[model samples]
Target: MPETKKFLYVNRKAPYGTIYAQEALEVVLIGAAFEQDVSLAFLDDGVYQITKGQNTKEVSMKNFSLTYKALGDYDVNKIYVEQESLDARGLTLDDLLPLAWEDEDDDWAKKDSIKVVSAAEMAKIMEQSDIVFSF
Candidate 1:
């Protein structure tokens, strides 16, 4: 029997003022519901999804940043981001949500398998996935 496609959803937008982040999170939640091996890659402005301590109230938007924190509850922990993208925006992993796996061991930096890819390297990761969706 053919294998179920290993799914990947790539987000390339910022969290606020756009629905891409919310929509991508929805896909992650839904995919986890089905017990699929789902991984999410944040690129470009999408890294903002994991940016720490966002306050949406100023704009009257609900705190959607909290929604990202819930990904662990849904077992959507394979979160990845582009290193260069984060650097371009002057963000580091320290400025964003820590890996959920680190919660169990407190060795997040060691266990962090979040792929930090360049634009060229990102293409290779995309080629590796059986199914890839972009937003």
Candidate 2:
């Protein structure tokens, strides 16, 4: 069997007004589909991507924030949000969506996937990843 490599998708942009955020999400799902070990890091404006109550109708863009909920189904549950970024934006973990995954080993018990970490911790996570995709 081939060794599984840890893939980290780093999002540093806002959800709208650009394509970086959306493209990154699509790639993440694709990577997960290939059975790769996937992890997501949200920092800077990227934290806004998973926030709750997003209204993009005025912008005439499809609201893709809800697509994040499907990550758990792809077995991509490791989502890390940077605390400094959230604090700078005057937001908290409560502002983000409730993303969770089911643990098959634990009889399919639901578990929270979003983790709030310090900037230093996020850096360590990036360093630990075998491949890092910045968007």
Candidate 3:
């Protein structure tokens, strides 16, 4: 069997007004489908991608934020949100979508997938990744 490598998808853009966030989401799902060890890092304006109550009606765009909830199903559970980025945007954990995964090994218990970490911690995570995709 091929050795599984840690794949980190780093998001650094806003959720809307561009294609970066959407493209990153698609790539993450594709990577996860390949059974790679996938992790996600949200920093800078990227934190907005997972924020709760997104309304893209006026912009005539589809609101894909809720799509993040499906990541857990793909086993892409390591979602790291930068604390500094949230603070800068005056947002809290409560302001983001509640993402969780079902642990089959633990009797299918639901567990949270989001981990809010400091910028330093996020950097360490990036460094530890065998392959990092930034958007």
The candidate maximizing lDDT is 2
Count the clashes in each prediction: 0, 0, 0
lDDT, each prediction: 0.76, 0.94, 0.92
Better TM-score candidate (1, 2): 2
Q: Which stretches of candidate 2 lie over 4 Å from their true place?
A: none
Ordered list by lDDT, greatest first: 2, 3, 1
Q: What would the C-alpha RMSD of candidate 1 be, to one decimal place? A: 3.3
Candidate 1 steric clashes: 0
- Between candidates 2 and 3, the lDDT winner: 2
lDDT of 2 by residue, 10-124 (tens): 9999988899999999999888877878899999999989999998888899899999999999999999999999999999999999999999999999999999999999999
lDDT of 3 by residue, 9-73 (tens): 99989977899999889888777868888899999999999998898889998888988999999
- What overall lDDT, based on C-alpha atoms, would model 3 receive against the true structure? 0.92
Which whole-number lDDT from 0 to 100 does residue 124 have in model 3?
98
